[model samples]
Target: MTDRSAAGTTFDDFVAARSTALWRSAFLLTGDRHKAEDLLQVALVKTWRRWDRLTGGVEPAEAYVRRALVTTYTDWWRRRWRGEVPTGELPERPTTGRDGPGAVDVRRDVLTALAGLSRGQRAVLVLRYFDDLTEQQTADVLGVSRGTVKSQASRALAALRSSPALTDHDHPATEEEPS
Candidate 1:
C-alpha cells in the first residue's frame, strides 16, 4: 500500500471536498450561520493540527473533524453567554422565494423547537437524524454510550413532539405513526 503521507491528500484538499457538509453539520449544531462558520473553522484547525496522523483519504479527516466539531460545540455550551450581543444591523429574514412563507415558517419553527432542547438532547438529534449517523457513530462522536444516545434521542423526540411551536402547526416535527 502506498503511504498516504507521501501521496497528495493535503488538508486543503480535504477541506475543499468536505467543507460544505461540515459547515451544514456545524450550522445544525449552532443554529446560527456565523457560529457555524466559527465552529467549522475551529474544527478544521484541530484537524489540520493532527493531519499527519489522519492520513488516509478524506474519510478519516472528515471523521476527526466531525468529532472535533461536536466536542468544541459541547465545550462552548458550558460557558456560553446568556445575554444577547447587540449588532448594528438586523439579520435579514431568509427569502422564502418560490417556496413561500410556509416553508420558511416551518424551518423557523423546527429550529425554534430544536433550540428549546438541552444541549445533549439537541446534539443527539442533530447527529442522529440530521446527520444520518448510526447510534454507535453518534455515541462515538459525542463520547457517550449507545444507550445514552438512544435515551437522548427518545427524550429529544418527545420534547419535539410536545413543543408548542411544532404542536400548533399542521405538520409536526416527526411524522406520527398509525395507531
Candidate 2:
C-alpha cells in the first residue's frame, strides 16, 4: 500500500526518519516511557490530520508536529486528573545488569531532578538543553518570549542543583584567601 500525504511525501517516510528523535523528546518531556508513547501518538495523529496544510516541506511538518506535542502536553498538565490514588508501595525491580553503573545512576538522577521541576521549567530545560535548541527557538516552541525562556531555564537549573538526588556535596570549596 502506498502511503503518501498531500505534500508528496509519505507519512511513513516522515515517521521512519524522525520517530526516534520525536520519541526521545517526548520521553524527556513526559518523564515516563508510557506517557511519552501516548504523547507521541496523539501528536502524530493531530499532525496527520493537518498534514496537507503543512507546506514548505518536512521541516515545517516537523515543526507543526512538535508544536502539537508541546501544546498537548501543556493541556494535559492543566487538566491533570486528581481522581487517581497513589499507592505507597514500591514496585519490584528487575535485576538486569545492562547499563553501566555510572551512566544508569546519572540518568536516573537526572530524570528524578527533571520530575521535580514545574511543567514550564521542565519544558524549557528539555527544549533548551536536551533538545539543543537555542533560547529563541525554545521560546518559539513554547510560544513564549525569549526572556521567559531564559528565566525559566535559570529557575530550572537552580531547582536541579538544589535537588538532593542530583547535588554533589563532595566537591571542595575553591575560594582563594584574600590578598
Candidate 3:
C-alpha cells in the first residue's frame, strides 16, 4: 500500500498499514493475544470515530490510536477480574530449532518480570523501550508529565534488574537515550 499524508489517508488505509505494529504494542500492554485483539479493536474503533479530527489535527492517526490504546488499557486494568481459570491441558506447538534451548524459558521469565510491574510502569516500559517512543511521546500517550515518564521508566528498569526471574541472564549494554 502506498504511504499517504495524513490529509490524504483513509481510515482503512491507515489500519491496513499500521494494524500489525499497533497489535504488537497492544500485545505488550495486555500480555495475551485475545486481550490484545480486544484492546486493539477498541482503540481502532475509537480512532475510526475520530478519524477526520485525528487526521486533520497536528498529531498523526497513529499517535491518537496509541493514546487510545493506553487509556483503554488503564481503564480495563481498574475493572479487571483477578480470578484465574483452570485449564485441563496446555496447548502444544512444535518448537523451531533456530532459537536454541531455554528461549521459551527466557521469554516466560521476561513476561513474569513485566507482570510484576504496575500498569503505569509496564505501559511506560512498553511505549518507551519496546515501541521506541521518545520520553515526551510516551508522556503524551500516557497523559503524564515527561518527568513522570522518566521516573517510571527508571523504576521499571530497576525493578527488572532486581527481578529474581531475570537475574541469571546477562544483560546487554544499554542504548543511549535520545536527547
Candidate 4:
C-alpha cells in the first residue's frame, strides 16, 4: 500500500467531489441556505486538516466529511452563534437560484418537522434515513450505540408525527412499520 501520507493533491478534487452533498446535509439540518454554505465551508476546513488519514477512499470519501459537518454543527465552540429560520416555511429552493416545484413543498415540510427535534435527535434521523446507513453505522457517526440510534429515531419521529405541519403527510421515508 502507498504511504497514507501520499494521497494526491487535496484542493480541487476534494471540493469537486463532496461540496454539494455536504451543503445539502447542512441545509437539511439547519433549515437555511446561507447557514448551509457556512456549515460546509467550516466542515471542509476540518476535513482538510485530516485529509491524509481520510483520503484512503476505502469507503465513501463523503462519510468522513459528513460526520465532520454534523459534529461541528453541534459543537459548543460557537456558543454565541444563532441560526435563523423563516417565520414561514423555508423556500422550496434558494431564492438566489431556482429548482423544480413538484414535491419541493413536501420536502420542505419534512425539513420543518425535523427542525423541531432536538439537535441529537435530528442528527440521528438525518444520519439514518437521509444517508441510508444502518443503525450501527448511524450510531457510530453520532458516537452512540445502535440502541441509542433506534431510541432517538423513534423519539424524533414520534415528535414529527405530532407536528401540525406534518398533518396528513406520510413520512414513510423516515419511519419503520411495527411488527
Q: Say which candidate scores most in TM-score.
A: 1
User: Which one wins on lDDT?
Assistant: 3
Ranking by lDDT: 3, 1, 2, 4
State the lDDT at 159 in candidate 2: 78
Lowest-sum lDDT 10-residue window in model 3: 84-93
Compose the digit string of candidate 4's lDDT tens values, residues 91-172.
5554233554445666677777776788889888778777788998888777888998999998997888777667758744
TM-score, cand. 4: 0.77
lDDT of 2 by residue, 7-54 (tens): 777788888889889998998887667889999999999988887777
Instruction: Let me know the TM-score candidate 1 reaches against the reference structure.
Output: 0.81
Off by over 4 Å in 2: 81-103, 168-179
Write one digit per residue (lDDT tens) for candidate 1, span 71-156.
89988877673443323233447765775866656666777777778889989998899789999999998899999999999899
- What is candidate 2's CA lDDT for residue 10? 73
Candidate 1 deviant stretches above 4 angstroms: 1-7, 82-92, 96-101, 168-179
Candidate 4, which ten residues in sequence have the lowest lDDT sum? 1-10
Query: Candidate 3 or 4, higher TM-score?
Result: 3
Q: Candidate 1's error at 40, in angstroms? A: 0.7
lDDT of each: 0.78, 0.76, 0.79, 0.71
Per candidate, the number of residue pairs that clash is: 0, 0, 0, 0
Q: Ten consecutive residues with minimal summed lDDT in candidate 1?
A: 81-90
Candidate 4: residue 140 Cα off by (Å): 1.2
